[model samples]
Target: MADAELYAALGQLKLSYRECIVLQKIEGYSIKETAEILTCTEVQVRNHTERGMKALQKLLGGEIDEIG
Candidate 1:
């Protein structure tokens, strides 16, 4: 995808600064690890990730897939 499309997808996800930071900056964790680090349940982390990805797909005008 083009840079603009990529950025637009990310932007459309509406992730808070903190959420984005946690997902992108930490980078070395499995979802479970990330959830633990964030002090949230694994389900919550998965939900956010699902929502974020869905939003991105919508923004990019791509097909949306079932989350998990």
Candidate 2:
């Protein structure tokens, strides 16, 4: 996706989910590192990432499988 469009999709996410995606996916942080930086449990990081990806995919009109 284009940069502005991608950022717009991310803007649609809840704040915590957006932070998780930015830290873990965009910044290339490990899951453990994301949890540490976000000051949340690893489970929370995982959950946010999952939901964020799903939401982003929906906003971007893309099909995303859980396996991805």
Candidate 3:
């Protein structure tokens, strides 16, 4: 889908999840990098990215399959 649609889907998530997706996917940050930027653990970022991508995928008609 388009960036707008993906962004809209991202908006449906919780703030932390949205931030994780934006930092890791949109901003091209690795899990370690995202964790550092977000001041969270790498495992936390990983979990957020996984769940966020799943939610985004469901919202965008299953178009996202990267983070999982």
Candidate 4:
């Protein structure tokens, strides 16, 4: 998808601030780095990543699962 389309879809997800930050790929940091940046535990980062991705996948009609 185009950047604009992806951004629009993401906006529709209404995610938490942390989820949005992580999903937006801020500098493409790993989970550890993201946890440090967000001042949260690595578990929280993983949770956000998983939940954000699931929401995105659902919103985008589950096409992400077909990528493989």
In model 4, which runs have C-alpha deviations exceeding 4 angstroms? 14-26, 65-68
Please provide, for model 4 over 1-68, each residue's C-alpha lDDT reduced to its tens digit, 9 standing for 90 to 100.
Answer: 55665566667764564353443364567778777767888887777777777777777777564211
Q: Tell me the whole-model lDDT of each prediction, alpha carbons only.
A: 0.60, 0.84, 0.83, 0.63
Write the residue-wise lDDT of candidate 1 on 1-68 in tens digits. Answer: 66565655565555543363346334546777777777888787777776676666766677544322
lDDT of 3 by residue, 1-68 (tens): 66677767777899999999888777899999899898999999989988877777788887765542
Q: What TM-score does structure 1 among the candidates reach?
A: 0.61
* 1-68: candidate 2 lDDT, tens digit per residue: 56787888788899999999888778889899999998999999999999988888888888444321
The worst-scoring run of ten residues by lDDT in candidate 2 lies at 59-68
Best by lDDT: 2
For candidate 2, the TM-score is 0.88
- Which pairs of residues clash in candidate 2, taking residues 3 or more apart in a chain or in different chains? none
Best by TM-score: 2
Note the residue pairs that clash in candidate 1: none
Estimate TM-scores for all models.
0.61, 0.88, 0.86, 0.71
- Once fitted onto the true fold, the runs of candidate 3 whose alpha carbons sit more than 4 angstroms away are 65-68
What clash pairs does model 4 have?
A: none
Give candidate 3's TM-score.
Answer: 0.86
User: Between 1 and 4, whose TM-score is larger?
Assistant: 4
Which stretches of candidate 2 lie above 4 Å from their native place?
A: 63-68
